[model samples]
Target chain A: MDGNKILVLDDVSVRYRKQDSRSTSDIVKRILGKSPRNNEFWALKNVSFSLERGDMLGVIGKNGAGKSTMMKAISGTLTPASGTIEKTGKICALLELGTGFDREMTVKENVYLRGAFMGYSKEFIDSKYDEIIDFAEMREFQNSPFRTLSSGMKSRIAFAIASMIEPDIIILDEIFAVGDGDFRKKSQQKMQSIIDNGDTTALMVSHSLQSVRAQCNKVLWLDKGRMVMFGDPNTVCDAYAEYLNTGKLPQTESLAATQENPRNRLKKNTGKRLAEAAVYLMLLLVIIAGCFVWSQYDLLKSYVLAQSLTVEQIENEAANYHRQIDRLLEVDTTRWDTGIFKEGALDIINEEATYTDVAKEVLLQAGDLSRDQYKKALAAAEIEAIKYSHMARLDALVAQMRTEFEAQPEGKYRSLMVYAYTNCDRFYDLEEDCENDMQKVIEEIRTFQRKAGQSEDLADRVWNAYKSEKTYLLSYYCVKLR
Target chain B: MTSDKANHRFLLSELIRRDFIKKYKRTTFGILWSALSPLFLLLTMDVVFGTFFGRNMPHYTIYLFCGLLLFNYFSAATRSAMRVLYDNAQIYSKVPVPKHYFLISQSVAQAIDFAVSLLVFFIFVAIDGINFHWRFLYLLFPMVCLYFINFGIGMFLSTLYIFFRDINYLWPVVTRIIMYASAIFYDPSILPGIMRRLLNCNPLYMCVDYFRQLIIHSTVPSLSTHLIMIVMAAICALLGWFTYHITRDKIALYV
Candidate 1:
């Protein structure tokens, strides 16, 4: 318990009660003195050691071997289930990466925060602020939020603050793993410098064998939570390294060498090669499938669009012709003897009758008509209307078709465009109407551009195609719509 | 020996200030948070429980605040002490100072926060234009009594925490249970006969009642009961000191 001794742990044992395979209710019953099956895990058993002034002790062990548990006990982060620990000086422990740092605070503020947590006054921290920053090499980032710092930078700052407090005993738990190679080396050197000051006793936990050999004067080897070896650095480290190599004590180099046989190396290489090949094959398959899916989507879209447009055009023309026939018949009953009707009554009546029959036939044939049949019907109606001086009715029908074209469902119109683009035969037959429709679309887009205060060049390709061959204009509209 | 003790006391004071400042260093509210905690608690508890318990009581917020402020100091101090050793296990492990210093510092820190909170309560009382009596000066008696009571409990629990880590989880439950048991938000006189007798046995309730009587009601607590409270507080202090002295060496081993 004397100040000269610095730190001592005698016969430390930490045991955790393993839970029963039974339910919690069963465990409660067992607590009332009923028998229940259970197991026990000893995190540390019969661990004993002493640390002297200026001593640098490195603790090394495999995962779950209780190295951390021992550090916790020494640092007073955890109480031993059984044992005694005595210390004679102020102790500071850095058990986590950036443990006391508040991410919302600036680097300067976090330095003071950590200082305060270690029980240092604000004045003390202020005096040491520059030294802390210099050690962390983050002078430029002093006002930056801790959350903005890289992990390596944060660890460096944390280490700087922890070390600047000048405690008699400094306990570090695996903090060396932070930072890049250069920063890690610098940090290691700084730690070594602290130990070299001879006023501080350092207890470090690290898995790096090289670090232990370089920095520690004494080595403590923990195995399954028990102190297996405690002695000079070279002897303990040698034994520990041997244990790692051969999974046993008294290891021989020749045995270790022979254990690393070429056959195993070859097997590992082959496994790696196979894994690489599998990854490459997976990547190649993904690319091929992606291209196939994209092309298939394009084809499907074109087919549906072409079909929808042809159907919409045929339906609109038939509807217009039917409406005209209805008007003509209404006149025959209501206004047949009027003066305007007397002038062109017979001719108009004949044309109306012809259109009525054509509309009914077109409506009937609409379901079976391919793209070609619909275009032919449109052309035949245009020629007949021209001969009978019913060109106005044909223009009305064209106007009706244009309105229907714009109002068609987005999916149906898109599929119709894809259909027109994919089939060159039907595309040519519908070229003139498609060209006119494209011109109308370009005009509509230009009007939208003017209203939206955008450039006329927005739809130049469509206007240019309309001015060129009609087939090209049709193809352009089909592609653009899709 | 006295100089060494003075140095230790100085260290304890430094730790108290550090603890208080650390809590609000990066916070924009800063020291205002210390005052805000109790003020918020007083307002909430007054609104919630005052409607039912405050019909007969005059200036209920003031009455509730007076008692609540004192009780809050006690609860905060003891709760913090219950975890003080565990929270600062690192310091205890390496430092050769008396373990009671940490507990004392924690109580002192809470006392400072309570003082700030008291100022806020006074502002409210002033705004409400409550009449003051010269006997209000005696309010210090109960305040000192509460402080000692909290200090004694803090010392006891800080030592206990080194041995039992489960004390950390048990503290909040104990605090909530004692909150209703004490005369924090309501007058204890409203309790039924047997329950009132039981409440009388509570040290915190007696201390708070004394404050209410002296400050709000403008009367001294019965001399006999005051004497009993002083004796009880002395006994707790002695017990706490004895427990700490006996267990001080073992804390570093345990924690």
Candidate 2:
């Protein structure tokens, strides 16, 4: 909390849940109020560290030793599950080399973008842009996309951008592992200059103990998410070196054991979470309500329109609508059912005579009629069915003219209208018989329409039903009065 | 929280700029695809359904374009935004930049594409012989609302995606359903009564329908349209933000 302290951490602990082990079924089970097995591990546990102005601290740890996690916690990317981290000023983090640089964008563009990621303003980046390019020695390929650059070149650019930004704290993670020896020496000099500025604090996580001993004044050693040592650079570095060699800590009092227990120190209050849960519940309810209102939006619009209209206006609209319908009804039109059978009857009438004769003999046997009587009845039935088909076609043409005045009706209505009017003129030139086969055709169509309606599969059902009926009607007598 | 005011503004512009560049990267026609792709879709859909519905509906092409523009924007923007967190895990998990900035930038980039497509839409409108009117400017209202809605949904989806990769597979199916329900290529007026009402519930349809009302019918949108849009935008944005705020801290670990 002191003025010189640029960054401070008090008992910061970060827990990471392994999400890969969770399955979709587990999610459903959890939603059903059954808790799944926990798969959480502490990435950083009760980590407390502080850095003052001009302090150069080096963090040393083995793989999976919570080095990156601690840096992330400091940079503000990953919030600690339990603990408080207080920082005095902006943090410029280079956690990964070329972290925010777009591979497709030019190196120059990446500088500005990466600088922005570090929380630097455009004008500020612009002012420092030339210095950064010169420092990274990327002037020749600055216009080229970042991906075209070598790994060392990318790291230099990343390092140059972070070093040029004059933030209160700068976090660098393994940036020195890349680039040539020349670049390393140059970057080391840059770090020295930053420390010499006496106004900025730096935290570097590195595996190079030599660099930590040479450049950093303070050192912190970590092992498995727990801080093992924090002291002068040489002392901790020696201890870390010996530990790495022997896989054993120095015979010194344990820092982790001396620190206060994390559980008792961490807040256990559930009130805030309970309130959040209630708010989430309310949000879900409101969302559902909103959906209901949205679903009724059409109704809402009509109600609004109705409200805006006077009684006389409503009456006038209603009268106008009725008048239109009356005009449509006045024109003599074919029934919706009559037009359907006409099309079916025409197909059968157009078939080859030989095929029909064979079908007629089969139908005669199936019908149990005397052969001579069957032949005569089949001829009469054929003429009557053909005549009815012609009359139905004539009725259709009249209906087309009636529906023409109405606005474009779509879906079933339009199909009905179209079916009625289609090819009606073609039947006009043909000879006609006055006798009607209305009773049989009407019965078949009603059956088809009923099948279509009940199944809610109108088009397919109608077509399938008509196909089966077409086979029986092929012989004319087969469809006779049944 | 690390980003101050100036930094936040610069970061947003940069992020938007990156998204815009990435969208057309390596493509031959590049940004023109924004206009050409939708125009191509419009032509195909017009040919397929134009004779069926076009004969009865005046300026049917314009009506279809209005729906296509809004629906495509909503679909593309939200879908891309769904993966923003996962895609940019390299940056956000390392740096402390605000996570929602990426979502905002993505939605804005898609909004830019919508704007370009809008220009193409107007060209078709003129070719179809419909006169332009001042009321068309009111389209800004729905466009802005739609941007928020897309951003909000993107935020919500991206959050879910970080925790559950299955969302990557599930979202397209949902968007497909939304595409059908939106009635983008077809006229809602022709749909059955109950169906039309349900379609109204789809926010994408509402935005598309408003565009048609203004561009094709030349009728001013009613107060209810504006109210519904604003309400939808607010609810979605707030809900998205709430979910995001709740899970943002955990996102780094998950990603």
Candidate 3:
């Protein structure tokens, strides 16, 4: 928990599952939680270590001893299935020499290009440009293609450029093996200086026991993916060398033994994961809810806008529509004036006027008419026809009464008037309408009053008097016949 | 999380440059194919649909181009984004930069392709004598919205691709369905009422519809339509980011 401990590996174990081994169906089943883990192997088993600031830790192991895997986990390229790897500073994993070199590019270009892969800015590489060339002793060949260089030259330049990266924690994988002997010594001195500075910490993998003992104050030795020793470099490297010579793993304190029980640790890790999942789930809910609220806001806004009018307002609007129709009717009255009923006019017979022509002439005369005016005209015409029919019936009844009076002159004049009035009422009351069965008797009366060469005063006098006493005169005619 | 955002911004330019270089490396066409392919697709779509399948399609070329460019950008961005972890495992394993830098960088590269294809599309508009009205200026709005939406989907799918890997193959079919549902060749109005309504809910379709509403229809989208697009982009971005962060730690393992 102090500032001194720059890196801590608390019983870290990395498991590598055979990713491509399972069939598609098996993978689906496994994903669906219908099956268990398949073809998974733990590469590191409860390995634990810690390094303080300015600490130099050398890792010594045979091939496949989980050394590379531990380095990868430290650099965060591999995720551990269990345990934890925590570092408190900037970590620069110095991978293989010339890891990203473009063979077609010059050595100088490779420096910039490789620097980018190492996550260094162009300006940083620019600042460190000269120093790298001097260290690698490739100043003369800096402009030459990287492919043209000798293998030694390439490795020297790559190592020189990579080592210029000044970070808090440095990860070295067989880095000391770069360059020839003198260059190796110079690079080892640089490594020692980086460690001597209180600001830097290093974890390195090396095959050389002598070099590890010479350069590193502490060493970790591994055998078949198990840590054999972790202590003073001289002691551990001596033990490691002894084991190599004797072909046996020496009995030593297990570095992972002091760690907490893994079940308790699993519980802790699971608790942390559950908390993370809870946070993510809560965030997800908030997002979904926010999305819903946004859409609903839009929906609600449009809904409210579309449904803005109330039922009472709609009823009021219907009333307003009726008022508008009346106003429109008032605006242009002639457009609705065409007569639809012409049956009353069709029954009229005249020597000069055909019924159809009479109807057409009446229609022509009903100019600039409205609906009410047309209806009134049709009713008047119908009344005139009824009056004419009644006039004819009155004449027939009067004639019959006169024939009876000849047989008996004093017979009932009341009977004659009653029959004449009852039968002739249609002609007397000349109210016009559609579909009536008589012609206009007023026209015939007017024609009789307006006979040729008659004086104007006499015509006017007879027209008025005739309307007043026509029924009286008819009853008198019946009495005279008697 | 804030530090991750800063990391991406710090290396943003470099990341984009690296992505562009990586995408077109060693190819004679370089990045020109980004524009060229959409042009070719537009031609093929115009010929096939304008002459035959969609004979009733009004301005079929531009209609198909709108969908093609936007969807193509989405496909390109997501395809590259899907491989961000697996393809650049070397750099990621060496450094501790944020994974989102990869997504943004890839999306920017796709945006360039989108811009190029769009330029070609506008030229066709001029050739066809479609009025390049002031409304066309609003196409920028939808274009910006589409890029972000595409970024969001890329982040979502690429994150899932790390876990499942099968999503890589499934994605093509998924995009094809989206394209069909988007009314890329045929007008969305030609779709059944329910289908059109459902298509309105599609974020890709929403973006396309927004563009068409502005440019093709020469009308601003409704307030709700604009809201849906903005919300869709915002929500997708939110989900994409958190999905990435939540699954980010497991990316190396799963890949």
TM-score, chain A only, candidate 1, equals 0.48
Better of 1 and 2 by TM-score: 2
Interface RMSD of each: 28.1, 7.0, 8.8
Which tens-of-lDDT digit does each residue in A307-422 have in candidate 2? 56565653444344443443333331111122322333454555533223422432322222333333333333343345565455445543654455354543343333233234
> What's the TM-score of every candidate structure?
0.53, 0.73, 0.69
The DockQ figures for the candidates are: 0.01, 0.34, 0.17
Could you give the CAPRI-style class of model 2? acceptable
Tens-digit lDDT track of model 3 for A364-390? 343223333433333344334444544
- Per-candidate Cα lDDT values, in order, are 0.66, 0.73, 0.67
Ranked by lDDT, top first: 2, 3, 1
lDDT of 1 by residue, A169-253 (tens): 8988898777788877887777778899999999989998888898899998887675668878888898998889889855333
lDDT for residue A62 in candidate 1, whole number 0-100: 90
Candidate 3 local lDDT, residue A266: 65
In order of DockQ, best first, we have 2, 3, 1
Which stretches in model 1 have alpha-carbon errors above 4 Å?
Answer: A1-8, A16-27, A35-40, A100-126, A140-149, A165-168, A195-200, A250-482, B1-109, B120-134, B148-192, B231-255
The recovered share of true contacts, given per candidate in order, is: 0.00, 0.62, 0.26
- Lowest summed lDDT across 10 adjacent residues in model 1 chain A is found at A257-266
CA deviation > 4 Å runs, candidate 3: A18-21, A28-35, A82-84, A100-110, A113-119, A133-157, A177-199, A223-226, A245-277, A292-482, B1-10, B52-60, B126-137
